[model samples]
Target chain A: MSTTAVVTGLGVVSPNGLGIKDFWAATKSGKSGIGRITRFDPSPYPARLAGEIPGFVAEDHLPNRLLPQTDRMTQLALVAADWALADAGVTPAELPEFDMGVVTASHSGGFEFGQGELKKLWSLGSQHVSAYQSFAWFYAVNSGQISIRNGMKGPSGVVVSDQAGGLDAIAQARRQIRKGTALIVSGGVEAPVCPWGWVAQLAGNRLSTSDEPARAYLPFDAEACGHVPGEGGAILVLEAAEAARRRGAKVYGEIAGYGATIDPRPGSGGEPGLRRALETALADAGVRPGEVDVVFADAAAIPELDRAEADAINAVFGPGGVPVTAPKTMTGRLYSGAAPLDLASAFLAMADGLIPPTVNTEPSPEYGLDLVTAQPRPAEIRTALVLARGQGGFNSALVVRAAD
Target chain B: MATKEFTLDDLKRILREGAGADESVDLDGDILDTDFEELGYESLALLETGGRIEREFGITLDDDVLTDARTPRALIAAVNALLGAGAAA
Candidate 1:
């Protein structure tokens, strides 16, 4: 068999919780983190609510030196990477730097950092801008910074498919592992809650304007509106199964399979890419539709997107064939961080035998999904599929199975 | 010639604000001749420090001059040279 890629460690920074322990606890209990935006004044904006990670003082998690040089997104990612490496019990000094790699996803590269520099350039003179802005605002800086910090000299790259980028980056890491790299640090973390980022997201026209926290980001609901944008995400450590077994590391699950596709041009008489992405992932994993224990849905929360996702699920696994959950309803859609967070939650669910609830959604029966909502459900979940779609027609699917 | 001399104290302050000292290093020591890299300030940090110095002193240092000044003493000398030349001009 080809080298199997397995997840050995997870580090989460979510609106509901900072690490895996608190995040999983809150997720399984159906606690919602969506609230009024406190990072900046949202009174001027239509969509005023978001899932911001509360009480996160970057200085508490990182050294003061990094504070001036990094943006919030990079700082959060660096912390997540540290936590993941510590959780895996792997020391960079002990491992061969050439055997390790990093692959992460990013949607918007340091919007707040760029905006701040731009403000200085416009108000003051060009000379007032900080030189750090050159690299801080680049999308690939997360991967570069993590690689430099860990001394990982192996294959490294960043994916930019928006929300789908999370899975795409993980899948890329898995590919590297299969190609003989011993370990890869993968996943994404995003912090786009600043004024500049909010305006950019507002341009998408897919954010909930509802001021009520509980009802704002209802996905797959009769009153479905739109997703609430959020900050933070999860970072995971992926290692080759053989290497993990040799080290006697605790394996969370295997990154069994992944598939992605792009929708055709709007005027093209072609089908949407979600169904194909699902079918391809199932085939890639050598898994039948019936074997999947649960699905962590994309849950865009828009009526048309929800219907399309529901239709795709029905066509693939049959209506109500498998239980579906949108745990993101609690933390809001994390953009590049969304799918990886779902992947992490899937592993946690498998370990605990509890499917986390999709909070605040009264799944409209029209979707034909056995939607898990309002409360956590106990199940024998050995296999899971995670789905994510990005704006302007990007679709990705990943299947993770419990490792023996 | 210049209004006031740019002392080692000013360089220390700028260095701390620009890149911050490494946890193991001390900024208050008598180490004016120490290499910037050993003191935990890399090229980028020095570049930022140079920018601040230019803005604060109202005198621009050449990019080459900044890159060549790898120690606190060298950087201080470079800034003082620019200040004297600006005053003369």
Candidate 2:
């Protein structure tokens, strides 16, 4: 029999708010964090609004000396990891270093820092560039930084599958636990607020060019144009169920199943990758589609992507529709941070017995999906399906069950 | 050229502008002792202030400088020292 991996602790530094309490409060209230860009001038860009993390100070959470060497994304990851470690009550000094590991995803790796370094080199000279620039911008900086800071010496790794990387990171952590790793810190953090990062995102053609925050990105709605980019996200501590029980730790939820699929021909719309991922996850969880109480959708906010997700959900649940919510609409899209935040929200929803509303949603009756909107809804949710699709055609689904 | 001597008022003006504080703030007051909530200067604002100071003074502030130079007076003193050293070099 395979061992179960359960979520023991959760930490979030989202656009909604930093830490779990603030994030949950803002999310449950259906407050949108999207606003005008404050990090840089967005006057020249087509898109204006973004879900930027407000009042974040890297030095407050990290050592002042280390601030210049690390990227904003790594700093966010470190802060979230600190919260998760404290929440889990597992000090790195107490645990066997080899037993704990880190698995994180970063869609945009140290973009702000990389851009800064490039500017320094361009404007000044090569001598003015800092040496830390080489590694700070790498995709694995989050995992590396978390491991080094927390003294985690186990299998540290990173996933780069865009948005799906967040879910995949948690799923991979679950696998590590089953394979004898004692603890896994998994999730994602993205800080791509620099001018260069914004330009790179504009090339993707998925960003909403709208001026108003309310109508910026509306998934499954007729007015849906595209997604608004954002920063920060959530991180989770996943421990083996037996280990958690031994320690008398609180179990948030059980990682019942995870499924991932990739379509090489992205945007072709030939294969139903979302359906395959969802079906596989449900099958792995040993739960029928009808047993799912709620679903946290990807909510891409693109017409075709939204339709694909709606069709996938309808096909699985027999068109009767399950209560679907996309909280990402409230925080634009945090790239790699999107899925983990969804997972965190899913865990909280199951724990609180409520479904959070999808903000800024003007539901289309033709979509045939029960999109939760306006206000939070109370429900007896024991199981949830969290879904995400990456820009380059990666799809991931995770099934979480309430701890008994 | 030797380091430029700045009056308390000049230091205050620089702090207000560098820290992104409103003009109404008192320059002679205890800005550093003020809590973040009271001052309304967030982390981003501090970073921006640090960058502006570095560019304006043409000196790289060590971590110690940032930590110890909490008030406008202390920060100005530190800047003067760095400028003096630069002139000596």
**TM-score leader:** 1
Tens digit of lDDT per residue, candidate 2, span A1-404? 99899999999999988999999999999988899999999999999899999989886777543565688889899999999888888888998999999999989899888998899889986645655676789999999989988899998899999999999998889889999998999999998988989999999999999999999999999999999999999999999999999999989989998899986575575866889999999999999988899999999999988988998899999664699999998898998999999999998898888899998889887788998998999999999999989987899999999999
Q: Over the stretch A1-404, how does candidate 1's per-residue lDDT look in tens digits?
A: 78999999999999999999999999999988899999899999999999999888888877666778898999999999999998888897799999999999999999889999999999998999998998998899889899988899999999999999999999999999999999999999999999999999999999999999999988889898998999999999999999999999999999988899999898796888999999999999999999999999999999989998999899999999999999999999999999999999999999999999999999999999999998999998999999999998999999999988
Model 2 stretches astray by more than 4 angstroms: A264-269, B1-89
Residue A161 lDDT in model 1? 96
Q: Per-prediction DockQ, in order? A: 0.69, 0.04
Once model 1 is optimally superposed onto the true structure by TM-score, how far is the C-alpha of residue A350 displaced, in angstroms?
A: 0.6
Q: Each candidate's chain A: what TM-score?
A: 0.99, 0.98
List runs of model 1 lying over 4 Å from the truth.
none
Top DockQ: which candidate number? 1
